[model samples]
Each structure stands twice: as C-alpha cells, then as structure tokens.
Target: MFKYDLKKTLSEKVFIFWSMIFPLALMSCFYWAFGGIYDIENSIDTRSVGVIYESDNEFATYFGDVLEQIASEEDAILSVSEVTDKAELYGLLEQSKIDGVYLVKEDSIEVLMNPKYSATDSMILKAFGNFYVREYDMIEDAVTSGNIGAVATILDGMNEDADYMSKEEGIFAQAPNPYLWYFYSTLVMGILFQAMSGIYIVEQLQADLGVRKVAMRTSVSPVPKSRLIVSVYLSRLLVALGISAVTIILMNRLFKVPVGNRLPQLILLVVAANMFAISMGEMFGLFFKGSMSSRSGKGTGVIMASVFLSGEMIATLPGVFERYAPIVNDINPATVLNFALYRLVYYEDLTTFYIEIAKIVLVTVVFLVIATMKLRRQKYASL
Candidate 1:
C-alpha cells in the first residue's frame, strides 16, 4: 500500500507541476526583479575622493595622512587619489571620476563637489574635514608645549575611535535587501502549496466526487481504515517534502537567495512547515467534508487568505502588521515561516529558530489530532 501510494503521489503531473516546476519559474522571476537591489544599496560605501595637498603645510600633510589611513582600512569609506595639478583634479571632479576633491588648508581641509552628483559623498568628506579641523588646535597646542604624553594620548585616542567606527558589528550589521522580504514571503506561500495537496488527501478518503473513486474502492478492502489513512498521509508527506526541498535548493543555488550557513536547520524548518501545512489541509478536508458544497474552492480561498495575510503579495504588509498588531504573526503560518527564515539569516540564533520549529510542530499536532478524531468518527455508506 505504501509503495503504491508513493508511486501514485509521484506520478500525478498536476501535483509535480504546481509543487516543483511552478516554483522554479516563479524563483526566476523573483531573481530578475530583486537581484540588482543589493548592488545598488552597496554602492553607497567606498566613494572615491581626489586629494590635492599643499605639501609644505604641516596640517595639510597631516590631513593627507589621515585620508590615507582611512582609505587603507577594511571596508573603507573613501578611495583616495593624489592630484598634483588643480586643473586635473577639478577635471576629474567634473567628469565624476571622483566623488569629491579635498583641498588642504593650513588649519582645515575644504571639500570641492559638483552639484550634479549626489551630495552624500561630499557631505561625508565635509564631515571628516570638520572633525579634523575641530581637533587640530589641541594637536598644535600639545606639540608647542612639548606635551609628548598628551600628543601620544590624542593620536592613540583617534586610532581607537577609527577602529571602533570601522567595525560593522551591532547597529551596523548589514541589512538584508528589502525586496528579499518578497522573495521569502513568496517562498513561504509556495511551500503552502502543500496545504492544497493536503486538502486532496482528506478529500480522497471522504466519500465524495469523481476524484474519490479510489477511496470508494479502498474502503471495501480488508485493510484497516487507520492503516489506509496513514499510508495516504505518509505518501503525500514524502511528495510534499520532496517538492519543498527542490524549491529551496532552486532558490538558494539558482536564484542566490542567501539561505546562509544553516542549511540543515533550514531543511528541518521546511520539514516542520510541510507537516503543519499537510495537517492543516487534512483538518480542512475532514472538518468541511460534508459541510461545504465546494470544499476545494473554500480550501483554496482560505490558503489564499493565509498567503495574503502572511504578506506574500504585499511586502510592507508583514512589517506593518508585525509592528502594529503582533498577534497576527503568532497565528499566520506564512508569517511564522518568514520570521524563522529571517532569524536564521540575520540573527542565526538557534533558540528562536527552535522555538519556531516547536510552534510549527505544535500546530501540526493539533490539526493532526483533530483530523484523526474526525476520521475515526467517519462511517462510510457502502458503495
């Protein structure tokens, strides 16, 4: 029965199409739309700056050294180039070869920028100049007074400040692209296709339409109803999970969705999610079997509503609802999946990951139990 059921599940063309092929196609579309966004956002860092120094001036040389030091640092904010001639420097600035030009004065540095370019890069240059000018008097005073200790202390403090600012930990952690929310939300919605397959699992067992002809035949067999139901569940579970694995692999490998280092944990989350969706599908089928005239229609509607609320369709909906009404995320399967994946990629905290897994398991168990009760109470009219 297990072997036959498995074969039957795998052989269904519509099942394979929706479960596997459709997601692969959808993933391609998602990549096309969102792939370039990361590059655009990352362009904000490491702007090019042209530096023309007054070599004889001590503060200018000092300011140039500061630029070199900053430019050499890891994940540098500026790329510095020295221009010996003012015409060449301004020419580079005009051509947009550099973001801004730094003119060194005795006490301070001046920023030269073209109005056509974005002001952010020039603003950064100006800020750096302002900060250095603000501190130059102290350095001059310390050197003239022969306060060698104070000079060392100030240089050391500046180096320490630079190091601290360079480290991108805590608040400066790299953010996932906003468009990724749509990809993740869509992935979760695609995974919910399991629930659609799940609805059929319940429908096939219940005495129903032409699709249930096999159920009618299986009922007359000597096999226990419990065993038959278990076989169906196991067969569909394997199919659903197999399709999910394919979807995830395509997303990570082909689409480059950045599933991260927690590959095994991600597979586990997929497993738990499949279980929840399948169980929910079964519960829907059993609960509404005779009650609804069009069980599939209503089931599909519910799944669509779940997907919409999960923010699969609208990217901001998830953040908006999550921020305004926290309770919605608690019940929405799509939201739970979104949060779990987000935690895995961004935080990589196992405690929260496992908690989400547990929640999915809990949801699965609840629906499974309810469906089991309904199936047990079900008595068929002889065909």
Candidate 2:
C-alpha cells in the first residue's frame, strides 16, 4: 500500500511543478535579483580618518592615546591620520584622502565628514565619537563625586583587552546573510505545498468526499482504515522529505546558500514540518465540504497567506510582527518553521528549534486525532 501510494504521489504533475520546479525557479530569480546587493552591502572595510588636536588637555591626550591604540590593532576598523591644523584636515577631506576627520577639543571631540563619504564610514565615525563622549562623561562624574573606586572600575572597564561578551560559534563560521531568509522561506513554501497530498489522502479514504468511485472502493476495502491511513501518510511524508533534501542540496551547492552542517537537526525539523503540513491538509479536507480541487485551492490560499505573513514576500514582515505582535509569529506555522530552520542553521539554537518541533508535533497530533475520528465515524447509505 505504501509503495502504491508513493508511486501515485510521484506521478502527479501538479505536485512535481508546485513542490519542486517552482521553488527552484523562484530561487534562481531571487539569486539574480538580490544576490550581488547583499554581498556589497554586507562587506565592511577599514576606513581612513584624520585627527586634529586643538587642545593639549589631559582628556584630549587620553582620547588621542585611545585612538592610536585602536588604530594599531591587527584587525583595526580605522586607519588614523594625524593633521597638524584644520587647513590640512579640510585639504584631505576635499581631496578624498580621508573619509572623515575628528577634531579633538578641550573636553570633547567633533566629527567632520567629506561630502562624498559613504554612509557606512560616516556612521562608524559618528558612533565612535558618541561612545567616547558617553564614556568620558561617566568618568568625569565619578571623579567629581570623589568616587575613587568607581573611577578605578571605569578605567578598568575601558581597557581594550577587557572581555564583556563572548562569541559562540555555530555549525558554520560564515557571517550572517540576510538574503538567506528568502531562500529559507521559499523552501518552507515548497514543503507546505505538500499539504495537497494530505488533502488527496483524505479524498481517497473518506467515502463521502472526493471522487465517488475511488472513495467508495477504498472505504469498503478489506484493509483496516487506520493501517491504510498510516501507510498513505508515511508514503506522502517520504516524498515530501525527498523533495526537501534535494532543495537543500541545490540551495547549498548551486546557489551558495549556507545551510550549515547540522544535518541531524535539520532532518528532524523538516520531518516535523512535513507532518504538520500534511495534518493541516487532512483537517482542511475533513472539515471543509467540497470537491478535492476546491479543497486544494483553499489549502493553497491559506498556505500562501501564512507564508506571506512569515515574510516570504516582504522580508521585514516577520520583524514587524516580532516587535509588535509576537504571538502571530508563535502561532503561524510557516513562521514557526522558518524560525526553526533559521535557528537551526545560523544560530545553532537547539532549544528554540526543539520548542518549534514540539509545537509542530502538538498541532499534528490534534489534526490527526480529529481527522481519524471523522474518518472512522463516516457512514454511507445503501441504495
């Protein structure tokens, strides 16, 4: 029965296009449109800046020393150039020699930028100035209050070698890529498309729905209804996973998307996702009174809406929901699956991943229980 169901599923042309070909094609379009932009936007290089000293106060000297130390680091973000006067600084800025200039006053510093300076360079310079001023104010307050211990603590905290945060390595050492969101969401949409198969499973088993002939034959067959349903469900799930595996391989190899090396966890998430999607289809089929095509169309609409809300089309939608309506993300199945896949691959957050898996499992069980009860109680009248 499983083999027969598998063969039947593989032979569906609509399933082949919707689940396999369409996703790959969409991925190709996304790659061509946004791939180069992400690469250029994410790249960060050292920036050049000029520093002019108009005052020789203690704070000015200390600030200069801080800049010198930061510029000397192996992976320094700034290359510092010392200017003798404002004339030389303005000269460099006009000539495009330095991206920005820092003017060191008596107790504070000012940032002057070239008209053509990149936004990234301007932001870095401004941020450094703001941070320095804030830290200096804290130290000044400590000294004025005669808090000797606080002064010492502030100085110790300012040490360049002080470690406040540690980086935890995930399965991949690659930096985060925002563009992967589209690809992952596309993969999710493809998986959800498998819900059509679940609808078909209902069409075959329930005597009152779908094609009258096939439904009646399956309903009266000698095979136990529970056993038959399990066989069909497993077969459809295998097909979904098979397609997902191929999608992952293509995403990693062909498109250069980093799906990470955590194969075991990834497989587990996709399995749960497929089960949830299929069970959702089962619920739709059992509850909605309609022909198979009508039910399939409604399922597709719901899935598309869920995907859109999960940021499949607009990348910022999920973020908006996260900040304003977080519960939308928690309950939306597509969002849950997308978050699970993202956490699994980029964050390597197994705790969140397992939580998402539990949600999927819980929903799947509820859907299956309702669907099973409905199928079991189905009665047909003899003519």
Candidate 3:
C-alpha cells in the first residue's frame, strides 16, 4: 500500500513542482541577486589613513598613539601614515593614494575622507573617532573634578584589553549572513507546501469528499482506515523527505549555500517539519468544507501567510513578531520550523531546537487524532 501510494504521489506533477522545482528556481534567483553583496560584505580590506598633527598637545599625542597601536595589530584593518604637511595629506586623498586623513589639533580631532572612499571604511573610521572622543571626555571630566581614582580607573580600562563579553563555543562562528535567512526561510516554505499531500490523503479517504466513487471504494475497503492513513502518510512523507534532500543538496553544491555541519540535527528538523506540514494539511482537509482542490487552495493561502510571517518576504517580520506578538511565532508552524533550522545551523541552543521539535510532534499528533476521529464517524447511507 505504501509503495503504491508513493508511486501515485510521485506521479503528480503539481506536487513535484511545488515541493521541488519552484524552490530551486526561487533560490537561484536569490543567489543571483545577493551573491555579489554577500561577497563584498565578507571581504574586509585594509584602508590607508594619514594623520597630521597641528599641535603636540596631550590629547593629540594620546590620539596619535592610539592610532599607531591599532595599526600595529596583526589583523589591523587600517594602515596609519604620519605626514607633516596637510597639503601632502590632502593630495594623497585626492589622488586616491590614501582612503582617509585625520587632523589632530590641540583639543579636537577631525576626520577627512576622499569622496569616493568606501562607505564601510568611512563608517568604521567615524566609529573609532566617536569612541575616542567619548573616552577623552570621560578623562577630561575626571581630571577637572580632581577625581584621581576615576582618572586612573578610566586609564586602566583604556590600556587593558579586557573582554567583557565572551562567545559561546557553539555560537555562529562567523558574522551573521543575512542571505542565509532568506534561503532557509524559502526552504521552510517548500517544506510547508507538503501539506498538499496530506490534503490529498484526506481527499482519498474521506467518503463524502473528492471523487465520490474513489473515496467510497476506499472507505469501504477491507483495509482498516488507520492502516490506510498510516500507509498513505508514510508514503507521502518519504516523497517529501526525498525532495527535501535533493533541494538541500542542490542548495549546497550548486548554489554554494552552507547548511552547517550538523547533518543529523538538520535531518531531524526537516523530518519533523515535513510531518507537521502534512498533518496540518490533513486537518485542513477534514475541517474545511470544500472539494480537494478548494481545500488545497485554502491551504496554500495559509502556508503563504505563515511563510510571510516567518520572514520569507520581510526579514524583520519575525523579529517584530518576537517583540510584539511572540505567540504568533510560537504557534505558526512555518516560523517554528524556520527558527529550528536557523538555530540548528548557527547556535548551540539545542534546548530551543528540541522544544520546537516537541511542538511539531504535539501538533502532528493533535491533527492525526482529530482526523482519525472524524474519519471514523464518517458513514454513508447510500454511497
């Protein structure tokens, strides 16, 4: 029975498209649009900066020393150049020989950049200047008030490389990749569409739904409805998982999307997600009053809405929901699956992953129990 059902499901062209081809096409489009941006974001090139001192004051000397110290670091992103002539520094910037220049006066510092300087480099330089100014203000205030202890404390903090925050062992090793969010959310959207198979299961087994003759024959067959439902579910689930595996392989190999190294956990997540999606479809099939195609259409609407809320379209929507309406994320199957996949790939939060799996299991059981009861009570007088 499972083999027969698997063959029948595989024969459905629409199912194949939604479960496989469409997602691949969408992912390819995303890669083409954002691949260059991702590369640029990850590549950090060192910038050459020139420093000119107008007066050898205490603040000017300290700021120059700080810049020298930063430039000396092995992985420094800035190369410091000291020039005595302001005209020479300006000439260098104008000719694109240097990215930016700093002017240190008696009590203030100024940053000058070429018009064509990289925006990222400009932002970094500005941030460094702002931080130095803030620290200088703190020291100035302490000295003016004759707070020797505060001045010493601030100086000690500036001199020491103290790490206030430590990274967890299993946290995302590199900077967060914004593009991965879209890809993973799209994958979850594909998994959610497997609910169509579940809907088809209901259409085949429900006596009064879908094709009357087929449903009638299936309902009255010698096979127990429980066995029939399980067989159909297993078959559809196998197909869904197979398609998902292919999608994941293509995403990693063809598109160069890294899905992380935790293969077992990833497999677990997709399996649970597939089951939850299919079971949700089963419930929709049983509760909604319509033909199979009508139910499938409604199911698609619901899935699309869930995917939208899960950040398939707007990457910030999930964060917004987390702040304002967290329950939406908790209950929405698509969001749950997406969160699980993301955390599994990027974080050591196994507790949250298991919790999401539990939710998927609980929902699947509820859907299956409700579907079973409804199908059991369904009787035909003259079918």
Instruction: Tell me which residue pairs clash in candidate 3.
Output: none
Candidate 2 lDDT, 1-383, residue by residue in tens: 78998998888778767877898899998889997875432423567888888899877887888888888998777788766577987898899988788888987788898866543355457657766766788988999999989989887866642211112232122222446778888989998998888898888788777566686777778887888788888888988888888988997787877665677888888899888888898987876666778888899999999999988888768877877788898899988898788777534236767888998999999998988877775476631
List, residue by residue over 176-291, the lDDT tens digit for candidate 3. Answer: 24577678888888899999988888888877776656877877788888888888889999999999999999988877776667789888888888988888988889877767
In the order shown, what is each candidate's alpha-carbon RMSD?
Answer: 10.7, 9.3, 10.4
List model 1 lDDT by residue over 111-161, tens digit each.
888776542344456656766775576778999999999988887766543
Score each candidate by Cα lDDT. 0.70, 0.77, 0.77
Ranking by TM-score: 2, 3, 1
TM-score of each: 0.64, 0.67, 0.66
Considering only N, C-alpha and C atoms within 3 Å, which residue pairs clash in candidate 1? none
Q: What TM-score quantifies how close candidate 2 is to the native fold?
A: 0.67
Ranking by lDDT: 3, 2, 1
Candidate 1 — worst ten consecutive residues by lDDT sum?
Answer: 163-172
What would the C-alpha RMSD of candidate 3 be, to one decimal place? 10.4
**For candidate 2, what is the lDDT?**
0.77
Worst 10 residues of 3 by lDDT: 162-171
Q: List the residue pairs that clash in candidate 2.
A: none
